[model samples]
Target: MFKAKNVIRIGKGANAVLARPLSGIPLAIWAFSLTFALALGSTAAQQTPPPNPHSPPPTSVTHQMYLDMKLGTLNIHGDNAVVEALVLQRDIPITYDYVATLMRTPNAFGEGPACIVCHSSNDQLKSYRGLNLSSCEGILLGATEAPANPIVIKGEPFQSHLIQRIRNNRMPLGTPFFAPVDTDSILAVKDWINAGALNDENFTTKVLPLFVDPVAFGSETACTECHKSFRDPPSFNEVNLTSYDAIMTGAFSKTRKKQNLPGLPIVVPSNAEASPLYQRLTTSRMPPGTDPGSPADHPNTLLLMRWIEQGASCD
Candidate 1:
């Protein structure tokens, strides 16, 4: 526990200056100073409650979702290919430990490496989202936002939100645009869930760094600055520009309804003019609060447009 101290002593001179009219300072500067002070004061006045250690971690499969991606795509990688191939050929069931090992290993396709980022007990998002994916049991608990549907529904992969979200590239929240879970990986999850998402797997944990696709990811990962993911009711949550795949996945738009058509493509390979991503940035409809088509954003936009013009290769 800590105690507050009166650190500032206002002398008569300082008081006199504050009490005096704003004749000396410019109106713009004065107004800016006042606004800054009020904002700071308001921030200081509000207090965030301390994290409760007793609060159990969220039990959603959000983190396990990443693990599922890793485990599901074992056939594509070199080392795991032997065992996975054998398992597939013999029609032998994939075991929990084998899947766990695959999860611990880094995926070649870059779905993700681990579940600790947002699912750990100490993770802030766990508390906010009421979902934890730190363990097999935790993942089975489902997201707080959608408790009715288990994140992984044993024997029914299609009914599982975990599969649906990953298939749609909506889970893992803030991944890069070109990094959707590949078809093979999605199928792996589907198979695993159908086999029952078991927890008996013994995994020797090792650190596998996340895979970054330089061509597609570039520098942007955060998109909430220009887009929203959470809606008032969780169901209304829309797709964000988190990755190249996400961009390609396309989002539902207000215009889609008015025009009575399906959503528009954000990126159309070899067609920058047709790309909503290029047009929106160039036309200045995004970065919501910025000057429309601000020059500051044009260079990146141009590079992206050119990439699209070159057929938007994922490689």
Candidate 2:
């Protein structure tokens, strides 16, 4: 602090200053100095650069405003004026169901994309990271590893881990680098988060799939015998293959010890090798002690394989 004549010059770092005085200083001089300092500060603040509204104010969250110009209904001078004058284009609000669509659909973001291929309720990878990106609720609930932070922050898009992971290509592991989630999809996630991630009021919730429908699966291999009951060494108790919808839902493997491959799908459409349902039926792996068995040549097994290869339409 430096005192000169009647005004005390208070140093406010390199770019600003505070002007005050003691009782001994002349009140008139002090007042004049204070006015001049305020004027100087106003000019300096204006010339500083574009104001970041998000930044906290020096004294409090409240900010000082002084507008000198106006045109029509718009302010043409001052920080708020500048911001109000410029047209800020906003995107349409995104819904919770929309995010789920991105997760379930293949190549929805673009080339060679598949999120549900690995992050479903039954997917082995879901347990590893504890994130089931299969549904909106799952995203909001977050993963076991990040229990403290929700995957999607309601109004802060960038703050959401879900968006950050997609933006940084940390999701859909094993996907080709050239065909990561597209920009539009990434932006959609951000927009959805910013829009409050509302769910569809009319959303008809269905049980997540465990396997392709055995009835619709075009198979007659008596799947319910082993799947419905644990009479054999391996029991498919996690899922019921008897019902059409139940079959389409997930069936986590009891034998797969790896927790890292969470939400692994059993009936990924259009890809035979990707679908465990198609694999188990086609091979002698199930109905134990049937290596090169009679079931391998069974027409029902062939029908099931064809159904999966044809994109396993649950409809």
Largest lDDT belongs to which candidate?
Answer: 2
Misplaced by over 4 Å in model 2 are: 1-90, 122-128, 146-149, 169-315
**Worst window of 10 by summed lDDT in candidate 1:** 202-211
- Model 1 lDDT per residue over 46-83, tens place: 34445457966546433322223333421222222322
Q: Which candidate has the highest TM-score of all? A: 1
Per-residue lDDT over 128-234 for candidate 2, one digit per residue giving the tens place of the 0 to 100 score: 35667676556666765632445555555434444434332212212232333334333333333234322323111221122222332223334554455212244
Local distance difference test scores for all models: 0.34, 0.38
* lDDT value, residue 186 of candidate 1: 33
